[model samples]
Structure formats: C-alpha cells, structure tokens
Target: MKEFNALVVDPVGLHARPATVAVNAASKFKSEIKLSYKGRSVNMKSIMGVMSLGIPTQSEITISAEGEDAEAAVQTIEEVLKTQKVIA
Candidate 1:
C-alpha cells in the first residue's frame, strides 16, 4: 500500500464538489483507495463515503491505495488533489 497526507486547501473542505472529483479519479483505477481523517476511514471512490467524513478546511487527511495499481492511484490522486486545489 502507498499513502500520503494531504491538507484540505479548499475553503469549503471535502464537500460534494471535491469529493466527487476524488471519486471520479479514484474509480478509474483498480486499486482500493481509502481516505482517512481523524479516526475514520472511507472509500475514496464513493462520493457519499467521502463527504460523510465531514472534513473541514485546513484539516489533514491521509489517502492510501492498495492493489496492482496502488502507486499510480496514490500518485494520481495526490496530484489531482493538489491540482484541483482540494488539498495541498
């Protein structure tokens, strides 16, 4: 598994918009993507799962992936999070 910590850069936090972006990006890969904040973890490919985390702005979260494409999935997601200004 590969993991990285990202800080929510969006003012609105991990709400529907950025969470949808993450789900869309994560669904394209075969890896199992997990996002964790505080003490809870959720499937990154599920919009509801992500938004339910209630991640607020400036909060830190960890994104991890496991499976054949774990590296690609983690890297792409990290980049997407930064590029999309959802996380930094």
Candidate 2:
C-alpha cells in the first residue's frame, strides 16, 4: 500500500465538486483507493463516501492505494486534488 496526506485548500472543503473529480479519476484505476479523515475512512471511488466525510477546509486527509496501479492512481488523484485546489 502507498499512502500520502494532502491538506484541503478549497474554501468549501471537500465538497461535491472535488468529490466528483476524485471519484471519477479513482474509478479509472484498478487500485483500491481509500480516503481517511479524522477517524472516518471511505472508498475513494465512491462520491458519496468521500463527501460524507465532511472534510473541512485546511483539514488533512490521508489517501491510500493498493494494487498493481497504486502508485499511478495516487499520483493521478493527487494531481486532481491540486488542480481543484482541494489539496496542497
């Protein structure tokens, strides 16, 4: 498994837009991706799961991926987070 933490930068936190962006990218990969915030964890490929976390702005969340494309999946997801200003 590979894991990395990203700080949410968007003013609205990890809301619908970022959740959609993340889930869209995550679903393309074979790797199993999970996102954790505080004490709650959810599947990255599911939009509801991510949005349900209610991650606030400036909060740090850890993303973990495990599988053949874990590294690439993490990199791709990280890029989206950065592009969406959801993570820094």
Best by TM-score: 2
Runs of candidate 1 with Cα error greater than 4 angstroms are none
Taking all chains together, each candidate's TM-score versus the true structure is: 0.94, 0.96
Name the candidate that leads on lDDT.
2
List clashing residue pairs in candidate 2: none
| Candidate 2 lDDT by residue in tens digits, 1-88 | 9889988888899999778988999999999999999988999999989988999999989999999999999999999899988888
Question: TM-score for model 2?
Answer: 0.96
* Candidate 1 positional error at 73, Å: 0.2
Q: List candidate 2 segments past 4 Å from native.
A: none
Give lDDT tens digits, candidate 1, residues 1-88.
Answer: 9999988988988788767877899999999999999999999998888988899999999999999999999999898888779886
Model 1 Cα displacement at 82 (Å)?
A: 1.0
